[model samples]
Target: MPTTRLSKVFPEELSEDTIHIIVQRPPRDLEFMPKNKRIRITEGWKPYKASNGKSVDLPPSWIGFLESAELEPDPRKAFDYLKNDLQAGDAINIPSMGQVPKDFGIHDQNHKVFVTEQMLELWEDMRGDKD
Candidate 1:
């Protein structure tokens, strides 16, 4: 009679397949706020002068779109929105807030803004699993 080793059965597999099986996590809970309901930050810019001493263009604003529907201007509120409000494919618009060039259309689509590793680590941390 031959005895089979448990190592032969498992072999302590450590591949992508094993990792995928071990790290199965639930889908992220997403919340979307209406575009008009969110707060928009109008950043300030400097004025430019031409050789004729005439102001060439107005300063541009760095628009920070917040996820809160309440239109709050606080940084912490903005951070909260960044963390909880928006998802991967959200759309953003500049809406000609400040001195941005008229030809520049700021309406853009959001890509994978939040990295997967961060979310994965967060999920693992929440589960109290350290691997």
Candidate 2:
């Protein structure tokens, strides 16, 4: 079965300033505790940002969050945030957000980014849902 993959997604409607990156809390792995007994750090995507400036740190599984984004002031700080306070910052969710495709075709270097009609529609509704 051929599944749709999106390497990078930049909804045409959302400008560069929108905080669209969705990050979840880092998981805890402990030898003392069984995998099932281990605490679930986060159940859903946390309203996290990579930098205070708009983007957020995401794992390789979610690396395809953004297709093309201009870097903010400091690149180093953003990396540190990933290590330290990824989900520690914002703890809210932007409604109207749907999961972007995760299977970003690892075999291909030229990552193909697909912005579907549904994605656009989902993003378009974000503003209305914002409290």
Candidate 3:
């Protein structure tokens, strides 16, 4: 199940949809924000030369998506949606402890995700280690 955190909203100062997040560094997150294909983070972290100076582009919006993924309101219904709606590399991201791959069963991949081409593309698109 996923969780969402809320911050103080200064409605008078900004638009309702605008979110603000500040942190010392990005957390170890692929575990929380998996590279799913249906939704996307159009803008990712990158180096940019701005009018002020050079800086990095970082967005914490994935946190919203995480809470929405609680597997948030109803895990049972969310699981159902994944089972029925996922296709074309889409997957159900449940914590499958002691789960084994079919046929091989050679190794237990409790924390593995089904990697697809789309997932790969999404990974490259996101802000990565290199500039």
Candidate 4:
């Protein structure tokens, strides 16, 4: 009998089943835990003025909340609250919030949680359902 060569078939992309498994896994709670110190403005820091002539201060207790509250890992949600709820103006608070330190930069002044591209990629990798 003559022998015939078998053609090889390759997948164009990863299988949807594999992708679903990777994305459907529950997100780690530690991944979403806030890992930064919160700061609240005191009375002495109240009525602080921004370069734009807008007041940019928080109540002492609220400052305490900012400086102490557990932050959400999702930068979008965090920023949304910061912009809408905190209203720290575009100066001190905004800048500080937007530029959280490397150890605490999970959120941004834009109130974006996990705003970095890498973070988004991680989110997709862990939650993508496209299969």
Candidate 5:
């Protein structure tokens, strides 16, 4: 069976000033945890600039949360508040994230999180009775 993969298609070349990336907290189900997680890229939603001169897609108030990265003495802890106290169904933002390589075919330079059969079963367990 072919493996599933994911990647981002950036609209333009990203620079440090233009975007803030956050590793998202994984969705939870019972006691099981997801092996992989995702990152949320905030580009101010692009083209629409808020008064603070940054773009906004999340809460307009969250712009401050994104910028709070600067307050963290330990760079890794940037956006710490969003991720620090999370419960099931709670999505939080993290400062740094990493990527894995592709599973098959040609080597995709882009990171690929190999979705295993076990992962699928976990999803089914989590989705139980939900619409």
Candidate 6:
């Protein structure tokens, strides 16, 4: 049998609500760090500017969003939010703190952002559910 399009199952508005991510580079800061430390290092959702003084638009803040996966204080389900609710291109409009440091390895101005296999690998690794 032929398969139906995703749009047919979900309305355009609902589908459009999803974020479109084009993986440019692998995720950053996948380590489990203290929230305070993480906050200190992070600038939230601020735009990144290039050395040429142009606003650099990066991909959706999946790392920031998933960083809070275990915020519920439950061990057994520490990563349930990430494993179940979140998808690759979910809408992530959180305000970035400002700009990340150049050494962060995510500041490359040339790479285009999109979803990549490495991202999924990192996601599973971050969740600590890898076999």
Q: What do the candidate models score in CA lDDT, each in turn? A: 0.41, 0.41, 0.46, 0.43, 0.44, 0.49
For residue 41, model 6's alpha carbon misses the true position, in angstroms, by 23
Predicted model with the maximum TM-score = 2
> What's the CA error at residue 52 for candidate 3, in Å?
20
Give the per-residue Cα lDDT of candidate 2 at 43: 27
Those runs of model 1 whose alpha carbons end farther than 4 Å from true positions after fitting are 1-74, 83-107, 110-114, 119-131
Q: Which parts of model 2 are misplaced by more than 4 Å?
A: 1-103, 109-111, 129-131
Error of 6 at 27 (Å): 44
lDDT of 2 by residue, 7-87 (tens): 244334555554555544556546556654443332233344554567554443244344334321344433342222222
Error of 1 at 8 (Å): 67
Regions of candidate 4 where Cα sits further than 4 Å from its true position:
1-114
Estimate, for each residue in 11-129, the C-alpha lDDT of model 3 and write its tens digit. 25544485656444657565556665213454454444444675645443543443344333433544443324334555445543332346532356343456577855565566276
Which candidate, 3 or 4, has the higher lDDT? 3
Q: Estimate, for each residue in 49-81, the C-alpha lDDT of model 5 and write its tens digit.
A: 566887646643455655565443435565445
Per-candidate TM-scores read 0.17, 0.22, 0.17, 0.17, 0.19, 0.20
Q: Which residue runs of candidate 6 sit more than 4 Å off their true CA positions?
A: 1-97, 100-112
RMSD of 6: 24.4
Error of 5 at 119 (Å): 0.5
Candidate 1 lDDT by residue in tens digits, 20-122: 3223355542324444333221233445655477764333422222222344434443333334444345543323222444445444532223335566457
Q: What is the number of residue pairs that collide in model 4?
A: 18
Q: Candidate 2: give the clashing pairs.
A: 49-56, 50-55, 50-56
TM-score head-to-head 1 vs 6, winner: 6
RMSD for each model, in Å, please? 23.2, 24.6, 21.2, 21.2, 26.2, 24.4
Model 4 C-alpha lDDT per residue in residues 1-131, reported as the tens digit of each score: 22222222333544544422222355655555454322221134555454577877656665565455465244555444332322222232322333345655344444333244564456467655856
Q: Give me the candidate number with maximum lDDT.
A: 6
> lDDT tens digits, residues 94-121, model 6?
2223343355436453323344567767
